[model samples]
Target: MSLKCGIVGLPNVGKSTLFNALTKAGIAAENYPFCTIEPNVGIVEVPDPRLADLSKIVNPQRILSATTEFVDIAGLVAGASKGEGLGNQF
Candidate 1:
């Protein structure tokens, strides 16, 4: 099974920085609010000790490791319900 994780927080709160470090997606992480208008998504394989041990014993042609999806969503702002500060767009 796969898992998905989203990084969300206030504007310029290092959300994109953290996402970039995790996924290495190289998205435009500017130093301003709403820089990440579009959500950045990336999938990375999860390292499993069990998989490695199994590979040694079974010697399969290929091993499919589990994966996790990380999404960097735009920052959330106050008054979103009132459609303020581009919050509604996000």
Candidate 2:
């Protein structure tokens, strides 16, 4: 099975930074528009102290916390709706 997530916003709104934080992966973050032409995506294990504590107490063979995916896609402009930039992606 597979899961997916996405990050989108106006250019330079910290979308890429947040994406990096979420997935703990490095993606090039550049200024100005159209910096990201293709999307950047990553999957990572979630770090949770509570889940670790529960595992210690319950002694379950398996422990699971929520995992999240991150994707950095190109931003858009108002003309996006009219087919400009990565607007079609939006």
Best by lDDT: 1
My TM-score estimates for the predictions, one after another, are 0.85, 0.72
lDDT (Cα, tens digit) per residue for candidate 1, span 1-90: 899999988899998899889888888888998898888899988888899899999999999998999988888889876877666564
Off by over 4 Å in 1: 59-61, 88-90
Question: For model 2, what is the alpha-carbon lDDT of residue 74?
Answer: 83
Q: Write the per-residue lDDT of candidate 2 for residues 20-40, one digit (tens) a residue.
A: 777767777777777787888
The total of clashing pairs for model 1 equals: 0
- As a TM-score, model 2 comes out at 0.72
Count of backbone clashes for each model? 0, 0
